[model samples]
Target chain A: MHEEPLVRWDWIGRNWPNIQVLLEDHVVMSLVPIVVGLLVALPLGLACVRWRWLYQPTVGVMNVVYSLPSLAVFIVLIPVTGLATRTTVMIPLTFYAMAVLIPAVVDGLTAVPDHVRQSAVAMGFTPLRRLLRVELPIAVPVVLAGLRVAAVSSISLVSVGALVGRGGLGYLFIDGWQRQFYTPIIVGIVLVVLLAAVADMLLVLAQRLLTPWSRARGSA
Target chain B: MVAGEGVGVNWLIDFFGDPANWSGPDGIPVRLLEHLQFSALSLLLAVLIALPLGLWIGHTGKGALFAVLSANAARALPTLGLLVLIVLLMGVGTDIPVLIPLVALAVPPILVNTYEGIRGVDPELRDAAYGMGLRGGQVLGRVLVPVALPLILLGLRIAAIQVVSTATVAAYVGLGGLGRFIIDGLATKDFPRTIGGAVLVALLALAVQLGFTFIQRLVVSPGVSERQAVR
Candidate 1:
C-alpha cells in the first residue's frame, strides 16, 4: 500500500517569511518603474497636448505600449537587463503604464470645456499661470483616471515580473506552479488580488483629494 | 533609460544568431511563419467564439453574474495553470493556449459592453417597443442592441487591442508568433533583437487600434458620434 500527500500546510506555514521577502522585492521593483514612468509620461502628455501636433505620435506610442503583452516585453528586456532586478522587471512596466497615462492625461486636458480656456486668457492670466490654475485643475480628473489605469495595469504587470526572477507575490504563483504546489499558488493569487484592490482604493483616495468635485459625483 | 549600451547591443546580436539554427522541416521563414499562423489562428478563434457568445450572453441578462465571474477569473488565472491542466488532458504544444486565452481574453469586454449596453437601454424605448407588440427577441434586436451597439463596440475596441497584444504569450509553449523573436532574444541574451520584437508587437497593437477605430465607425450603428451627446 502507498500513501500520497497533497496538502502542504506545514511547508506553506514555514515559508511565510520567504513569501514576504518576495513580496517586498516585487513591490520595490513595481513601484520604482511606475513612479519613473509617471515622471516621464505626464510631462510628455502635457507638452504633447499643448503642441497639438505631437498628440498623434505621442498617443500612437501609448496605444502600441498598451497592446504588447507584459510577458513579451519582459522577454525582450531580459536579453539586455539579464535575469535579475528592476532593469529586467521594471523598465517594461513603466513603458506599459505610459500608454495608460498619456492618453488619460490628454483626454483629461481635452475634456476641459473650450470656453474655460478662452476665459482664462481673457482674464489676462499668463500662460504659465493659466495652465497651473485653470487647464491643469480641470485636467486633474482625467490625469487621475489615467493614473488609476496605471495602478491597475502595474499591479497586473508585477505578476509578470515574477517570470523574470524579480520577486513579488508573483513569485509565489510562479514558484508554486513550477512545483505544482496549489497552496502557495492560492496564497499568491489572494495576495495579488488584495494588493490590486488596495492599490485601487489608494488611487481612489488620491483622486478624491485631487478633485473635490468628484466626491459629489462619485457614489462610492 | 539606457537606450544604448554594451550589454544591450551584445544581447541583440546573440538573439538574432540564436534563431540562425532554428530552421524548420521545410525552409527559411518556416518557424516565423508557423508562429504567425498560431497567433492569427488564436485571434480568429477568440473573435469567432467570444464575440457571438458575448453578444448572446449580453442580451440574455440571465448569465451576467457568471460572465463577470468567469472574466475576472480568466484575467487572474495563470496561463501556466491552464497549460498544465491541458497537458494532463492531452499532451501540450500549441493549440490549446491559442484557444483557451482567446475566450478568456475576449470574454470580459464582450460581456461588459453587452450587459452595460442592454441594461443601459432607455426604459422608454423598451416601453415603446412593448406597446408596438414586439416580442422579447424583437425588442432586444431592434432597440436594445442598436442603442448598446456603440458601447459594445467600445468593448470590442478594448478587446481587439488586448487580444492582439496577448496572443504573443503563445510563445511560452513554443507556439509561434513575434514572441518567438523575443524568446529567442532572451535565451541568447540579446537586447537589440528583443527590443526589435517589443517594437514590432507595440506597432502591431497601434495598427490594430487605428484599424479597429475605423471599423467601429463603419460598423457601429450610424450616428454613434451623435450618441456622445448623451454623455
Candidate 2:
C-alpha cells in the first residue's frame, strides 16, 4: 500500500491526454448545472428579500430540496426523465447547488452592513441599484464561499450520474469496484480529489483576484 | 410542468399502501429502515470516538494542529471514493459503506468544536486553577470540558446531519438501507416512491438538526457563545 504510483514519465505519456479529456468533460458537466442553478436560485434568493412572505416558505421548500439525498434524487429522476442526458445530470445537480446557494445568498445579502445600505438610501439609489452596487459587492465573498463548497460537491457528485450512463470519473470507480480492481479506481479517486483541490484553489484565487480587499481584510 | 406518468409513480403509492414491502428479496421499506439503522449505528460509533478524542486533543494544547488537519482532510476526501476503496479491501456487504461514509461525514465539526471549546476556556481561569494547584484531570473535568461542551455538541449536530444525508449512499455497496428504495424507485422510474425517500431523508435531517439545536440550548450556557469567536 505504501508503494504509490507517482505519475512516472511513461505513465504520464500514456495517460495524460486521456486524463485531460476526461477532466475537461467532468468540469463541464459539473459546472454547467451549477451556473444554471445560480441563475435560478440567485434571483429567487433576492426576491425573498424584496417580498417578505416569500422568504420563509421559499427557503423552506429549497431546504427540503437541499436535504434530499443525492441518490434518491437521481433515482427519482430516472423514471420521469429516463437514463443519461444533460437533464438527468443537471436537474439534480441544480437542486444540490440550490440547497447550499439559496441560504448563503440570502444570508450574504442580509449581512451587508447597515451603513452601506444607509449610504445607498441617502444617495437615493433604487432597491435594485443598491442591491447591484453596494449589497452584492459586499456579499460576494460569502456568496462565493458557498459556491465553492457546492462546486466541489457537485463535481464529485456528477459521478453518481455515471451509474446511469452519464460517463464521468464515477464510471472508473464503479467499474473498478465491480471487478475488484484498484489502479483505475484509485486513479479515479485521486482525480476527483485533485479536481476538488483545483476547484477550491480556483475559488480561493477568484476571491483574491475579484475582491482584492479580501486578503487585506483577512490579515487585518 | 408535466404531470407524473412516465415512470408509473402510482405503483410506488400502491406498494406503500400495501404491507408486502417488508419481505423483500430486498423489501423496500424494510431495507430503508435497515439502512437508517446502519447509519444510526455507525454515527453513534463515530460520535463516541470523535467527541472524546476531539476533547482530549483540543485541551492538550499541542494536539490542535493535528486535529485541524485531520478534520480538513476528512471533509475534503470524497465519500464515494473512500467507500469503493473500503469495499475493495473488505468485500462489501454492509460495514464498509455504512461506516466509511459515516465517519468521513463526521470528523470535521466534532474536531473543530472540541478545539474551539478547549481554547475558549478562560486563560485567567487556567492560571487561577494553577495558582490553587489544580491537577490536569481536575482542570479538564471542571473547567475545560464544560466550557467546550456547547461547541462539542454543535460539532456532533453537524456530523449527525451529514451522516444521515450520506448514509443514503450505502446501497452502492449492496447494503439494504433507504437507498435501496431510491434505487428501486429510480429503476422503476416511480417518482412518488423516489420522491418519498428523498422527502424522508430531508425530514430526518431537518428533525435531527432541530433536535440537536434544542439540545445545544441545554448543553451550552449563555456565556459559552460569547466566546465562540475565540478560535
Candidate 3:
C-alpha cells in the first residue's frame, strides 16, 4: 500500500471552505458559553458573596459538575436537547465555563479591600452603583484570569462535541481517524490550539488595558 | 412521544437491572476495569514526569517562567484532538497512543499546582529549616513538601478525575472501557446503554473526587488543612 503523507496540503487547499465553516462553528460555540457563563456567574457570584453561607455549597456543586466527563454530559443531554444540535454541545460547555468563572467573580469581588468598600459607602454610592462602578472594575484582572482559563478550556472542549456530530473542528478528528487520514486530525488540533492561544492573548490584552493599575501594583 | 420517552427511561433502568450485563468479557465489570487501568497508568506516567520537574522548578525557582508557559500551552491543547492525532500518527495497534494524550492531559494540572504549592511556601519556614542545619534535600523534604502537600494532593485529584472522565475516548479507537457502552450504544442508537454509561462515568468521577477529599483529610496536617479551609 502506498503510504499517505503526514499532511496533504492539496487536500487542505481543496477543503479550505469546509474547514473555514468548522473553524467558525468552533469559535461561536466556544465564545457563546463564555459570554453566557459570565452573565450567569456574575449574578450567582454576587449572591454567593452576599449570603456568605451560599459560597461553599455553590462551589462544591460546581466542582462536582465540572468533574463529570464532557462526553457523558453531551450524551445525557441528548434526550433533552436532541443529538447533533449545537445546543446539546453548548449547554455542558456553559456549565464548565461557569465552574471556572464563578470562582473568578467571587474571588475578584472579595479581593476588593474593606477600605475601598467603606469609601464607596462614605461617598453615598448606592450598592448597585458601588458594585458597578467600583467593585467590578477592581475585579477585572482576576475575572480576566478566570476568563482566560474558561476560554481556553471551552475551546478545547468544544471538540468533544464532535462525538455527538457537532464538534465543530472536532469533527475533523473523527473524520480523519475513521478514514486513517491525517489532514483533518492535524488541522483540527492546530486550529483548536491556535484558537485557544488567540483567545487567551485577547483576554490578557483586555486585562492589561482594563487594569493598567494592576500591572503597576504587580510589579511593585 | 412521551410514552416512547418513558419506555426509554425504563429500558435504561432495565439495562442496569439485568444480571446478564454484570459478568463476562463484555460486561460492565470488565469495562470498568479497563477504564480504571487506563486512568491509573496514565496518571502514574504523568506524575512521574511532572512531579520531579515541578519540584525542581519549585525548589530552585529556575525555569519557573518556562514551566508556567508550557503548562498553559498544554492546557490549551484539546484532548480529543490530541488523542485522534496520536492514533493517526502511531497507527493505533497498542495502547500507547491512547496513553500519550491521557498523560498529556493530566500533566499540566499536576505540574502547575505542584510548582505553585512549593513556591507559595513561606520564606520564613525555609529559612528556619535551613537554620536547623538541614541540607537542601532535607529542607525540601521536611519543610516544603509537607507544607505543599495539600495543593499537591489537590493537583493529583484534579488530574485523576480528568483522566477518568476523558478515558472514555479510549473506546472511540477500539479500546475497551466503560466508554464502550457510550460509543457502541450511540452507534447503535441504544439510549439505555448510552445513558447508563454516562451515569457510570459521572459516578466514577464523583467517587474519585470524594476519595481525594477523604485522603486530603486523612493525610494533610490539621493545621495545614484548617488553614486551607479558611482560605
- Give a tens-digit lDDT track for model 3, residues B179-214: 999999999988888888988898999999999888
Runs of candidate 2 with Cα error greater than 4 angstroms are: A1-21, A50-58, A120-127, A216-218, B1-8, B57-72, B92-98, B113-154, B182-231
User: lDDT for every model?
Assistant: 0.67, 0.72, 0.89
Q: Could you give me the TM-score of model 2 versus the true structure? A: 0.79
Interface root-mean-square deviation, each candidate: 3.8, 2.7, 2.0
- Clash number for every model? 7, 3, 1
Of the true interface contacts, each candidate retains a share of 0.19, 0.46, 0.80
TM-score for the second chain in candidate 2?
Answer: 0.81
A156 in model 2: Cα distance from truth in Å? 1.9
Docking class of 1: acceptable
State TM-scores per candidate. 0.75, 0.79, 0.96
Candidate 1 residue lDDT tens string, A1-220 = 5532434678778988998887777667767777888788778878888898998877766665666667766765664577766677788888877877777777888888989999999999999898889988888877876776676667656766665566477766556555655666666666666666677678778878878876777764
Q: Clashing residue pairs in candidate 1, if any? A: B11-B189, B11-B190, B11-B191, B12-B190, B12-B191, B35-B176, B35-B177
Worst 10 residues of 2 chain B by lDDT: B1-10
Best by TM-score: 3
Encode model 1's per-residue lDDT on B1-231: one tens digit a residue: 365456656654554456653565422266446644655665566566666666677666678787666655555444433433333234455466455655566667666766777777778978999899999889988887878877777677677666655555555445556666665666675555656666556666666777777876786666655765321
**Per-residue CA lDDT of candidate 2, range A25-80, in tens?**
77888888788878877898898767868878776677556655566566557656
- Flag the better candidate by TM-score, 1 or 2: 2
